[model samples]
Target: MPPATATTPAPPTAGATDRPGATGAPGRAVQVTWAVATIALVAVGTVRAAGWLFALCLVAAAVTGTLAVTGGRSPLGMLVAATLPPAATVRALSWAVRGLRDTRPAGAGIGVGRILKSLAISAGLLTLFGLLFSSADAVFADLLTGLLPDISPDGVVGWLLRLALIGGGLLGAAYLVSRPPDLEGLRPGPARPAHRLEWTLPLVLLDTLFAAFVLVQLTVFFGGAGHVLRTAGLTYAEYARGGFWQLLAVTALTLLVIAVAARRAPKTTRADRLLVRALLGTLAALSLVVVASALYRMQVYADAYGATRLRLFVTTVELWLGLLFVLVGVAVVRLRAAWLPRLVVGTAVLALLGLALVNPDRLIAERNVDRYLETGRLDVSYLSGLSADAVPALTRLPEPMRVCALGQIAAELPRDGLWGTNLGRERARRDLAAIPTTTGVTDCPGTRRW
Candidate 1:
């Protein structure tokens, strides 16, 4: 679908009350409340996560993701959107101030000189503000180290950070690309940035390679993109690390295609529009698969499971959103199909709002507050970067600690002496020895494995 023009945003609501087939209309407060609530949650989460580095990673993820979504192409939007709230959120917001400085949104249909001027200002502001908020060394050092210094090669944590940052960059790019177009001193789509083939050829080649890989995996291996990779028993981080190539490919392809489609998508007939609708739906489904795969990966790792695992693809979510938007878009285009548009939009809004309220994550977050809470063993290793933490966190655990300690204690005991627990038996023997009727020594119990 093409980008929303400066005209209208979505379907109408007033007409919806007359019709019964559509989803109900949600109050305006629904969206408003959700946004404020979400922002508050962000504030709380930033605090709960603790440490400037973690916050920065998140800021970077959010910043990048915002850049990509608002500017870049559709599939790019899809991919970034799918990975977000985790990878995207973590990195965009991590250096958000810096991201705003280093990377900012640009507009279309603007003259080259003016566009460049605006971009310069945007970039300068983002950079200046970023510097004010975050330090250089403070963040980079933490990226290489897990918050827990001990978990040297934190495969899971590191992978999460990596995926989020990468997604954020892609999202930011998409946002810029999808923007109307630079206006100042520019005709459209500049040519003399030094290299055309350098950009196009590489993108084309990378996208092609990814497509081929996805095709191979889909046909000969999994039957289709969704079946094998995200069947079940996967975790979010696992899927991210395990199927990153495919995820990246799908996201890139989707964004590129959508970008192209938006630019050239024909509107000759209702059928053409329908085709676009179908295409968007398919894309949405793919996005859902990407998300589902990620969620499943997380679930597997966390020993968690949920109902919406398969529906996680961003495409799926957006597909539903598009349906409502489509009615609005079509109604706007036709102008004659008036009464039904509002009703359709209102219903869709209500449905979408309802979905948000019923979102399993909202419930999950509420239900498992204890697990999400920050409390556990004396993990000083994370703060200290102990040599032992470099070993897998699971490797040197409660059982291992107990087993090793017990064995060392057993080795030093005298074989000839009656075996007894160090404290109890010795105390018993000593206490008994003071009594005339008591024996000289008390027999100790056999050594026991802890």
Candidate 2:
């Protein structure tokens, strides 16, 4: 025997981890759970009409599908993880098709083709017997009719098409779950820090600019309407509208600048880290003021001309941006931002879900209606264009305004099937049924667009 020699195991090959049974593959039970979840989420669309409910279903499906494929083990940033599922689903389609094609039995296992054939035969026999019994007994026929779904000939093609598309998508997702991609390998190397002068000067200048803007904002806040009219030679609404978009742009650009500065700032020493925190932290704090100013401008604008979708949406976005600034400030203090990416994405998803739950259309209608009661200024045409979600609120308006606001919505209200029903539309239908249908208002006052 050769004098004791040490043996080393070979290193795993590239992409080996992406294969089935590899470390990245989800366990069988996990796969089944996620698969069922995915199916249930997709099935929601077949049952619910498009609205907030559909939006929620979409979000759930995306999350569950991503979790299934990545096994929730992706090392990539949350932004990348959010986008990976769709691409993975598309890439796995061919693999799923090939799998279905090659269905020969392994060892003592049953063949897929044999199982499918047995199922087909069993279904055919059951159908034949069902038809024979239906002709033999009227009560049995009625019971069978009640038990089976009514598959109309007109909708059979569409139903089959939907089934095939959803089935194919599910199959692709299943394949990806069994064999996740090498996402960890795709994560980029750490960024190289810029030279001190390279990143420092821009950030310092930005801080100075933000400071100047904050000073102006302070002056405006304390100065009030008289100062704005005198200095800018513009009314409150004019001033608000003029600067709102510009301030929004500035806030967005400031966030980008902070991100770049944080990424490029060197942190090799305590002094460097402290400086980074001081500059970026101040910028984020000032950015919060800018967010506040943008929101205040929108409030003035909405006060001048009631609430609309655009104004409400922008306000929500500004609020989310304000929260982002707060998050950045916290991340800066800790000198550890690894959690920032995921938290940012999570907060965004929550914000969107929150917005949906609040029923934006309804909110908009309610705000406009309240403003009308106060200022006697109601935009009937605009309210009429709102979705069925606003029906309940719009119906609260006085006679002509209520009729005008609900005419279009009620006219366009779709009669969704049992599976395609939505709470919002159902409520709208019930409310509309109770109200008289005389088109009693030909010309609604304040029909002008704001």
Candidate 3:
């Protein structure tokens, strides 16, 4: 100090270092890779008809983009992560706009305007030269024609609009990678616990109601179709259909009730935790029975008629709801649910992906075909109305039925370019090509049962 000694400043404290935006920018390689992946996925998946590949690719692109921007960091609460995308996207867009308005380069990197200007100039020059060169030579022209996509005048505007949207989205996501948002800040604080009787009484009453419903379902299950006809004064199919919708509502409402009850229930003491577990666990268990009953009803209905898209979709939803009940049961047992939100979201995503992979339209067609084989009744009109995904199964039908079932789908099949190519469509086209073309089928035979 006497010699005016220069001292190194103390390093920033851990708390300061861990603050939002304190982490350095995401790596350049990561940003570039994410941009390419997102653009390619959206372009390829959506440029064509949406199918299983599109579904899978869309999810992948969203996850990749989210991870890229946040530097692979996720919130402790997965529910928080689930709600972060819209807010994060808005914040990123705002940051990007601010960046563009800044005169100086951020850090040692090129300024946003400069980079954008360079890109525009390069693109213009490349397009101009490429066009001129193509005009100068036939061989070169053919090569370029093959290499470049042929966008018609009518479609050029649409294509450009898609490009603009994709580009804007990528820019926002890229900036987010460079400056990760404070995800931890988005986590919600714990809820206030309700009074012991406040939560307990409602839950106990709900559980009792669920118990009564479950007992009635057991009676119905044991008594079979005869009892349903005798009591309900309707055919088993009608009874099943009516009961399914109501049971589905019950399952959904029960889940909501459980969520609200769990949030407000006290768990500070052993007695309170035990009571919570017993009440909520009983409710979840009864809800599972309701889910089963709903499924049984759907099975009865589908067997009476045949599987349709709506039937299959609702069945899947029911199954997912059943799984949610199981998950809630697990959470009830553990008395801690910090992991439940993420697991719930993950299972839903998996369920959707599973549906896509199974090819629901094809499954519906196949089930109906099986039913037709057994009962000698086919809904040719319904089969014909399905997407290309049903074509392969529809081809399995006999004679005029096959022709009628496939005629609309075959007529509607578009000759997709490289970007528009889809697995289901490709399979349909190939299957159609393999079969002999049949004509003169005026109308389908069967009427829709639904």
Candidate 4:
């Protein structure tokens, strides 16, 4: 008789499981590709100039790439997994590292040792020639000396640590792709049956509370400044400052509650589905009222104070939260939209890109300058601390204020001749240099500090 043939199970796709080593050759190939891409992203992000936009872009890329490696099939699932608290990543990393023990050898060799030896030989030749030329010519010696790295113990350790971190992160990502963690919780599972009465009672109670809150917001929102002062018994600035952040926090928490309730709620029957929609829709609508209140309060606060970067960020967050609630409403209407997660992520990415395009530093500077024109109180100290992008806007201020602003700005502007300067810094330097110095601003106290 013929020998019995053994059967090997295929690797898991989206909503399945694969034993260790069952991922096969294709999975390993994908792992290598994703690892290379992740490392490249991290390297570019690290070397790029530091800014809010650069940091945001780096984070977005790194996070999305990590999620893709984590076995998320749908864009929505990947995006959701990406935003999950750091605990999820830590768990996934731990599992990936543990899975390293199960790694099997490939049936091939790449002769990496030979490649390393060749690279070492080439480096040695280059070093020998460099040293010979430096010894023969003083200019060459200085140039080579400037180019040579200072190989101190601390420097070496730091460089090694950086390399290790990059290597380890890449390895971890590759391991995840090859052996994905058992994260059933992160998967988009079928909606479980929820008891209609069980969900209805709590949702109704929450809905009633939200309704009361909306009524109060309507009074404050439509009644104008006088109503706020009359009901809250505080000045507009005081009321604005006290209520906006609290309302924002409340709205955020409410959103979380609604999301959790809807996700866990059973919708087996038609009545259950309708009930879920009605409850979530009502909550979303009330949340919008709260969002509007938060925005209005922030506007009032910004009008009273000035538009700082922090305030602008909060305003953006509130707006984004409002958009999220709108998306939630849509999801409720559709009932089983797997596309919601992707929509949320896309909305967030667009918002972040919009913010980067707006250029917060310049926006803050311009708005502050306008505020100074109206109130005659330029926060010279604050303006000085802004990034180089604010220099042109600062030039628009009055003579002494302009001089003060430019002087403080010039202190931080890039002074490294021209070899390594960026366009933004160079532009700022030229604009500052164009400001003709006058004796009047010399008496300004802030200019003295500059």
Candidate 5:
């Protein structure tokens, strides 16, 4: 044999981390990856001129990223995990901080320091070149100007606040990844004995109240705003606006009451489950009618005042509530099923995604224009306030209205030089360019030309 040569022991296999019930703490690589992805999304949302929908995407991405970092497996559970409150996030963070007690060095002998130093050097050189290029191009310079931090007191304060919020949020997310939320409470469990009077008394009172309200809604729903206003000594707008928010409040309160009662409902016997089911089912059904009434009131209002992003979004929320009650009915029937909460949460997420896809600003413009076509009255002032996504729809309006709409939009649209990066702004600019002339509207201030 060759003269004795020392042989180093083989490093512990990477497989060691995957052994049964691994603590599931996010590795350094995972943490860095999640941080990069989240930062990229925020950068895109800022620099590319994305709309509210894109903002929502950022939130969803952040939530999903946090859940993944924590090692959550179920898609539905991930959805639920996204809703962890700040307090819960903090608690998890504390739990993760405790693990630091095992402070033995990780990645020992991997040349990690050398790798990090190389990465820093590469990044520094790249950034220096990027800054030089930004200085050389006027458009790129403008973008950099917009992106760079401002030195004013208000700007500094706002920036600091934003920085704090973002840092806190990331810390919370990292904590969540290490320890996902406990969701056992959402699952159906062994039936506990019920106190029938405690559950039913309030429910009976609530059911009666809701039933009476539904009776009143029949008149408003069929009799129309005119009849309700005339009978109640109020204007149509007053009746509609006043009742819309109030009904929403009522619906919210009723839902809360139902939730509390259901949580506390005795499920010891078949009869108890049936009774619980019957009361909750009845309340949910009645709530649907109330939701319909609220929707009708909103339609009446929108018809008179023109659609707005707020109104459109509110309509969507009511629709979601109606669907939720429908789901509740399903749950009432399958009382023993543990999947109802997950189903409800999944449905809500889908509903929100669908709303985002609808593009509320564009939809608002379309509805308003259609309303104008039918009634020959457009709220130019309101249409002017909408985002660039509304530009295409507004341009579709006929002649003088179209010219005026374009002028209003041009005034409000951001002239940020990165037009090519944003579909909405690019399309708006293109459409504005195509306008033959703003010739005829010289009388209307700021209504002259593209």
Candidate 6:
């Protein structure tokens, strides 16, 4: 999933770099100062506004810390939702620390190993940062629902995620309570299958149930052969003609394939194994491609329109990905075919390709600026080069250029929005109008007109 592009605090990190004494001391001191300041402010706030507000923040922080410390699996999500501003500040700071994590080791100069370690650590920090933001966002409860009038907010899917987290935690706790004695009791042994039918059976049953849902949905949605399966006076024909039916049909097919494979017995033949792997691989790849394509489309829509497009539920593609994951999970449990593993590999490849096609690098660069436009970091340098080579072309740009090429041109305009984006924008508007629907709109792709 695309990481939240919100202005978060620095990425998370251990911040254990061994830097010069001077720099390290000052940096550490600054951090300490900030921490002290935060604590003091909170304390003062508590003392002055010691009523429900201070008590609330304290209670909120305590609950969040408790949840995190307890390994609540869902993270301190509720706490984050309650304090988004503070969370954003802290998260941004965390990311900043991660970016500066490899500044130096005063005693030991940079080395190959250090370089690699730094890279790994930086990536890990960023990964953690993303997770933190995602978890925080997930806890929205209903704060945003009030802001967005179009969305119903807090749908069935969100309920599922919450339930899963809570159930998993409970299951983990139960397993730990019933776990067999540890290494001290073992004279000698290698790893054994981690689970038996007790675990496997339930998951298998769940797969079966999901597969059944898919099948029923398919019949209802597809109305294949125009066969109407109606209930309660609502004809399947009426429902199946819409987009929902097509999606359900596709999803149902995927589920049936998984369910069938799961119910089948495993074979020992090499050829059989290979075939199974290939089929699974292809299925997985296509699924991933669909997901990537969907995400890219959402990104485009969001940029062209506004983030409000995804204010409530995520894009359709994301939901499809979830369904895809469930389908694969079913397959993994039932299908021992050699082809199954390849499905995941294919999904990875196809997803990458789809994403590349859907979201070209140039578009992404532009969108990045659009997303951060509020911050005044809308980098319009994308047009700088075009200006050089296409200088003449820019000057002669058509009228409609302003609307189509707004991304690149707007940034160049003064704060007062005067002068309008270089001539290209003006040209865009003009060209869009004069150019018929048959002709594709064009622009100076270069950053400058050399």
Q: Residue-pair clashes per candidate, as listed?
A: 77, 0, 0, 1, 2, 49
- At residue 195, candidate 5 shows an lDDT of 79
Ranking by lDDT: 3, 2, 4, 5, 6, 1
Across residues 275-391, which tens digit of lDDT does each residue of candidate 1 receive? 555554444444444444433333443333221222332333444444543453444344333244234423433443343334323232222222323232222212112111112
List candidate 3 stretches off by more than 4 Å. 1-102, 105-108, 132-147
Model 5 lDDT tens row, 245-334: 998888788777866677678877898888988999999999999999999999988888788777887888788888878877776667
lDDT agreement of model 2 with the native: 0.75
CA lDDT scores, all candidates in order:
0.38, 0.75, 0.75, 0.69, 0.68, 0.39
Task: Tell me model 5's lDDT, rounded to 2 decimals.
Answer: 0.68
In the order shown, what is each candidate's alpha-carbon RMSD?
Answer: 21.0, 5.2, 5.5, 6.8, 9.3, 23.2
Tens-digit lDDT track for model 2 on 47-123?
33335445665766676566555543333533554676667668777775565576664676664456677999999
Candidate 5 regions off by >4 Å? 1-50, 56-119, 128-172, 178-194, 411-420, 436-450
Cα RMSD of predicted structure 3: 5.5
Q: Residues 185-286, candidate 3, lDDT per residue (tens digit)?
A: 565578899999998888888888888888998987999767877986998677888789999998899888888898889899999999999999999999
Residue range 1-450, candidate 4, lDDT tens digits: 999998998765853335321245654453354445445444433333226656666676566566446534354446554654354445556665455434345654434444456889999999999989989999988777666654679757866896776566565565555555543344566667567677789889989998898888788767887877887689767888888889889888987787777788877789778888999899998899889989988898777777777788889889999999988888888886565765665566567656665767788889988887887766687777787778878889887777777775676664432234455566777887787634456555332111
Expressed as tens digits, the lDDT of each residue in 175-201 for candidate 6 is 322331121122223224223343345
lDDT of 3: 0.75
Query: Candidate 3 at 212: error in angstroms?
Result: 1.0
3 against 5, candidate with superior TM-score: 3
